[model samples]
Target: MSFDGLVTRAVTYELKNKVIGGKIQKISQPSKNDIVLSIYSLGKSYKLMISANNNEGRVSFSNEKFENPQNPPNFCMVLRKYLNQSKIIDIEQYKLDRVIIFHISSIDEMGFDVSNKLIVEIMGKYSNIILTDDNFKIIDSIKRVNNKMSSVREILPGKNYNFIKSDKFNILENFDKDIYYIDKKTPDNANPKELLYSTYLGFSPTIANELCYRAGIDTRVNWGLVSEDEKKALNKNIIKLRSKLLENDYTPTLYKENNKFKEFYSFRLRHLQYEYKKYDFISEAIEEFYKVNKSNDRLRQIKNDLERKINSHIKSTKKKITILDKNLSKENSMELYRKSGDLLAANINKISKGMNSIRVNNFYDENKEIKIIIDPLKNPWENVDNYYKRYKKLKNSISYAKKDYPNQIEYLNYLLQLLDFVERSDSINDLDDIKSELISNKIIKDSSRNKKSNKEKSKPKHYITINNSHIYVGKNSRQNDYITLKLAGKHDYFFHVRNAPGSHVILKTDNFNENDLISASYLAASNSSLSNSLKVDVDYTEKKNVNKAKGSKLGMVYYENFNTITVDLSDKPKDLYKRIQ
Candidate 1:
């Protein structure tokens, strides 16, 4: 969205210097909404990327790699047919708007020379890449728009291309003449940010606020309230800006807040007042901005999708636990079945065939007489066999349920642990580990069933104490396993939060001091869900005391010979934690 008209002009200036006399050596459409052209000029080759993505559209010299499709799209084919091998004659902007037009010279079918125009519009959602003949007749476009899309303009083949006219004045043409128009036309109560972009062709909201800020005027005040001194300062600033633009002098900068990209432009932004990084050229700034933003978008989508699936499984697992608890409550019924079998066998000798019911059973309970039901059709022996069979069936069911109940509970806990890992993951590699674990557990199908795992495993967080003691902390289940089972020595100490989900911290030295133990315990507490608490109980033991829990998921371990440490985080050494980047 920051790719405004000024950005387009800066890019055009960049291309004019690099590729004006270059030949189109190669062309490829790496994505449906992007095209990359390889240009050879003055013994140098540059790959220029142009995109028409609705949210992220720009033109820049890119070094990023992309996977090209084997079968090109129709638009890509059309561009290759008409523009390939053509020499770039000139590059120009359309009156300071967000449009870059490239002039190309090539031979026609009959070998007659022809001149063509390649138009790139960087407007959001309406951005397009178009080709036309010398007479401005549309040849083809990357995105075709008909009347259904926009009644003002149709970008179909054979139509006379009508460049959209802007009522706003171009400030770069002649500042002396344009200054008059701006002074006379700006309304008294107009918002400075809105008025600048609406009055001038290339002035965006960012630059507008910057212009006000540089002039030492309060941006919240409307034009009518600005003092005469502030007005003169504003005029002076605009004149300087115009001169810089005319002289092709720019300081391309990328603004960041907390080390994350906030905005980028052709010139330094005064209003942002954040940590700003400088770039030699505007193209590099644009490329880096696009790459960072695109990667972030991809990461967010993947994270959301993986979390959705894991949450669904977690819900189902909880439901199963609920049902299992209900079934286990029926275990008391097994006793009733066993008691009835005993009573029937005891009264078998007193039973008769014609009797429907009998009271007897004083032997098993103080010999107190009790009533029993019998079938007249079946004999007493048959009734005894039926009671015993019922008792056996109930006992078998109870045995099976009890045996499986712990395993199911363990499985549910494992999923909850994985959800924690997913939430805390900071990189795509960490998520990949969690996904692979899910596949191995048969919770999800492996899409790349035949793919080989050649990537190196991820490492755990490493911290050292002030005394040069080494410690390792795990952020996920796989990393926990690696730290506890692989990296830890038998005599080394390990720390984890008591009866909670947390990281595994391993202290790799045998002869450790009290300070070393405190540092390791602090790490175990800080990396857990209860880090914000005033105090957290952490348990530590020798690595030999820790063993993988049976019939459970990865990272599930039981330990012995351990002692509890209440980690307050403030109790650790002042300079104890030094992380290895």
Candidate 2:
């Protein structure tokens, strides 16, 4: 939703001015749904992001880098073989529409001149990327639109590709002719934006409102009939749009539509402004837009995961409680024996009071009164032996239940946290981290379909480059152990957040400059639970003093020779973290 027509227009403007004539240095399809074009333009390289999965199917230019898959997909290989080193001769669009065409020129394998066309159709579900020869004969397409695939157009290779014509009203050409009729038909009582929207094609309600607001023409003018003056006002608005698009004389005027929320506004053709209140830069906004959408998608999966786990755990706990209750409630065989034995020994007084009374089975200790009956069918001798046997069974069951009850409670709490994290996660990496933690804690089992031969991979060690030196940090428990125990030299200084969940920072060398050591300490504090604290306390010590506890969890190490000091939390540490190149 963050990427509307406005974003597409801005991106188009930038591409037209900066990258249309650039040569395609590299063509990489890092993912099945994404294509990254590395172009050399004006003595510099630029990346253009073309995502078929996007709702609007944009081919926007981006500065964000995308990693190539380890084994490139078939489509990527095909593109690289055909489109690499091609010159982008021209970029054009059809009739002021969302669809765009890039004409690329390249040489054949035999070093002869050859040319191809990369067509991007951004018409929602009908969107596609079609590659064709100079003659417009389709060579291939990212998505093959055929008679079976689509009823509108069959875009199979070897056939000449054609642009989809606008069958709906053409606002510009028919404006003058229909203005009088449209004005006369406009309802006396209706929203102005809606009236314009109903009359225009390819213009959203937002655009219609802007157009109406800009021209000072009331869309709610008398519907039954219109005066000559009203018709002229409508014609004036239509002319404005024609001039902006056809004449290439766009005068973009941004309006604070909602005075309350001024930060959010629609820009009419404008240069890229890098200032956004919530985002660090315009690029950040784009990144956040994609990240938020992706997170929303993953949120459903994570919720489903938590629901299944909690429900399964609850079902299991209920079953265990039922079994325990049954065993505990069953009649005690020894009760009668105890009474008979007392009677035969002529100790009736001993049988009175609490002497011969039966005790409830230990299995039902949690609900003691649930089991209060004795077996009446068995003889005293048989009951005595049976009672002893039953007693032993209950004792064992009670011990097991006691241990299991706490574990179940703990598991449920952990699952709730997992759910909270899933719902609040802002990026895929955050979800991955949660999954990693769940796996490490054994809160979730691995997929039964997973290959057993593959070893459980540990979180990879991360390094931050500070002062041109690699500062190692532990991403997880085992990695923390390795970093502190094996990776850190004795002379190296260790930094950690004081009494907070955080990564263990190891300043790679024992001999370090005072400023570098201080920088490492600041980073350790910032990457902790108290990151937002006004003053973060960081613990520092020599690597030799830190020791691994016996049978302790990974990343849970003990240190004897450590000291902590509180330092004011400053944004300056972000600059240091950003140097991790």
Candidate 3:
């Protein structure tokens, strides 16, 4: 949200200095809304990334690598046709707005020298990349806007190019007059900082707040109630800001709070409450901030998706178990059906053909008298035969259900463990391995089978303890299977959270001390969903004692001869081992 006009100006300034005389060597469209240009300048190669994405529209020199599409998009082809091998003559911004122009010199199809212009508009939803002739006639745009889409302007090929009109004057050019006008137009209840940014060009709310803070004025106070002395202080700070812009005296800085990126500015943001990290270039600041933000966003999305899927499986499996238990309960009453059949047979001699009911001695229960209901249409012998058949069917059903009950419960536990694994996953590859495991076990279908397979097998996380012992933690079911079954030796130690879903941690040494065992148990609890709990019970055993269940899902194992250790989850080991992978 802080990528406003001021940041755009800073980016343009940085690009102009680096790529003005550079020749465009290659052009790539990695995504539909983004393009990357490779420029060879000053004996170095620079990658300039321009994006028109609605949420993350930006233009910066990026160090991140992107995968290119097999075939270029139409917009990329148009740019390559006109701008390839062209030398950048100049770079300029339009009136301190979020619009950049790259003037290029090259040859035309007529074998004569010609010039072209590439314009980048960094407005949030209306961002675009447009190419035009030297006379500002549009050739093509990354996104087309017809008459129906926008009433203000239509960006189409063969149409004349124009900048979006704005009522606010450039801050650097009309500093004094614009300040006076803002002061005049300030509403009675409006915050001065808000009024300043809303009524000026190239001034974001962050910069406006900084100006207010430097002037010793409360940014939240009403502008109309400000003292004359405060007004004078504001005017002085605005002049200082104007001077900085004019002299190109910018110290690009990024602010971070609680180890998360908060915002970045072209100049120092004194009003923000965070540690300021200065960067040598504005592009570097922008790239670093967005890279971490994007990675966090992607990780969250993957976790949510996996959680939803695993939870659905857990719900459905529990429902099925409930149904099976009900059926088994009914099957348990099979003995009553057999008894009724015997009672009917014994009373056949005393009953008539039209009798619907009879009272007979219950031979099974101390010869007590009992009431037996019969089908009126069938003879007594036929009635007894029907009851006998029903009894046999119920008895068989009970057998089958008893055989299936344990497997169903085991499957439910497996799904729950998967949910815990997904919630604890810290990387994209871990999620991928879990997804692959689900697909292989027929819990979910592999929808990406047709896509290229470039993913490497996820390896166990290796760590070194303070006493020079190696510990491996499984991040997903596939990794868990590998670590417990193949990589670990028979005498190695295995640890897991007791009666909970967690990672399988293996300490790969025969002579580990009690401290090593405690460290490994702590790790097992930390990788579980109950990591926030104050105390957790962990079970440890030798690898030889851990046996996989036959015909069970991956990572499902049975173990005995294990010792339980209660660990405080809040107490992290001081000399925790460094993770090797």
Candidate 4:
């Protein structure tokens, strides 16, 4: 994007047709690494930008606007001191390089006629603009490269003025230089494309490609592959590119479709009829490429993560179904005991109603008579039939529990498994899958309202660690029940802080020594309500000994046997054991 050569050529043509006078109306530094000059010539204002940014640095009459800094930097101050209100005498290019030297004549503070020069170099990373006095002594540069930052040539004040490298091809005034340069042999083993690109001036990458493509020769082909015909084609492309450069005819036509740049293809001004919206082509190309690449990467990561989550959900759901099927085969002894109690009550009711035989002793002061009586039966087998009815009803109830308990368990297990998957989900798609499953199973009445939370909800209270193989404290009432009764093994030692709302800790083993009890108690102390203020008091006992109150909340329990121990809440509960998985 070096437009210095083009601008120089345009200025040379304009110098012949217009008044030979121009004055710098404004000087500003719009960025940390750029300067703008507003020059007035022939009653028209031209805003020229000279940038020393690491990339996209060039000198051209820009149509774009920039925000100027309130306080100029030191480099800006130095340029303004010498170049303000200076008259432009000439604008010239160095040999054939992208360097542009602006010659200005002005009166100094001493009221003496003086000449000063400002040089704009449009090299990629090494770009800079240097200011020099009447004697060609360097004043300063936009970027001062030192040994620490760069190993290349350093640009500093008080040095003699010189170009970093000369471009040999910008020799419009020298006929001999142009005619003899093409016959020169390039370096051995050089890529034909690379040699053509660097040796020929003002050749864009696309034009270079067109040259190689038309010749049926690879750009990366070795120098030895350069036959007479291929060389002739390359030479032709070079001359054409240079002609355009000398004419200052760089009205760039981007190969854009749907407002996206396809490529930079060669097109004549007449061939391009479409109204293409203009942009800072160099900057836009780089920025859009990065933006598109980043979006694609994010999309790829989301797809991979979703795939992993779905597979894990499927495996876990199948496991829960298998567990439900296994638990269904267990005999419900507690339910059977309740049914037996009901049967005993029914038989007693029949005797009281005189439907069955009964024996009673009436106590009196004078005499107590013991009598056995039976009601006259409509049928002799009625009493036997009645007893069998009660027994059969109890048996039938138990059979019903046996027949349907497994199915109910499977249904409940599926609900819980799906809830887990829903909680683990992050994006909308994952939530949608969970919502669909919930609706299919009738777990939720309304699928639209099945989302977990729009506002943040409190997290689950219980956490299990493999380090000590213990269930740590619960954060709330619901988690207390979940960890103590549901997740805890029968043999796991349970601990609680006496008379305190704390977690029920399960030590994962029954045969624990005094040290294990103390360690678990410490964990119970750290996660309690009193954790911030004082050392905690803990009580512990077997879970079997703890009983839930008849009307108590889910986690509230009353115990028949327990012991108390006080522990400091100094140690972090999570630091107890090293291993965790």
| lDDT (0 to 1) per candidate | 0.83, 0.61, 0.87, 0.58
Q: Which stretches of candidate 1 lie over 4 Å from their true place?
A: 107-112, 176-189, 216-222, 340-397, 448-457, 463-469, 531-534, 569-577
TM-score-superior candidate, 3 or 4: 3
lDDT of 3 by residue, 1-581 (tens): 57877788788888889999999999999999898999999999999999988878889999898999888999999999999999999999998898999999998888899999999998889999999999999999999999999999999999999898888767778455645566776677988888778777877788888888888889777887887788888888888877887778889999988657889888888888899899999988888888987877787898898788888889988997887788699864798889999898877788677778889989899999988888888887988988899899888877877888788899998998899888877778788888888888888778884655678867888998877889999888777888999999999999999998888999998587987988899999998877889999999999999999778888888899999999997778777577777
lDDT of 2: 0.61
Q: Which digits, one per residue and each the tens of the lDDT, describe model 2 over residues 1-581? A: 32333334444555677787798988888676678899998888988877776463667657666878778877677677778998888887654456677888889999998989888776666677888898999988777777987777789879899877655455545455455666555566656566655665555555665565565555565343444565566567666665665444433332222211122222452222323334322333454455545556566677577557645765676677667555444435334334333332332222222223444423323533322233456544444455556556666666676666655544444344344444544445555555666676776776656434343454434555445555776554455677889888887878888766676888875346765666777767766656678888889988888887565455666676887866677645444544431
In candidate 4, list every pair of residues with a backbone clash: 96-170
Model 4 lDDT vs. the true structure?
0.58
Backbone clashes, each candidate = 3, 3, 0, 1
RMSD of each: 3.9, 9.4, 2.2, 27.5
The lowest-lDDT stretch of 10 consecutive residues in candidate 4 is: 263-272
Could you tell me the TM-score of candidate 2? 0.61
> Model 2 misses residue 100 by how many Å?
0.3
Better of 1 and 4 by TM-score: 1
TM values, all candidates:
0.87, 0.61, 0.94, 0.44
Question: Best to worst by TM-score, what's the order?
Answer: 3, 1, 2, 4
The window of 10 residues in a row where model 3 has the poorest summed lDDT is 174-183
| Candidate 4 residue runs with Cα over 4 Å from true position | 1-20, 147-152, 166-189, 201-207, 214-216, 243-251, 257-581
lDDT of 1 by residue, 175-264 (tens): 654434566766788776677788888788888889889878787878778777877887788888888878888889998775467899
What TM-score would candidate 1 get against the native? Answer: 0.87
- The model with the greater lDDT, 2 or 3, is 3
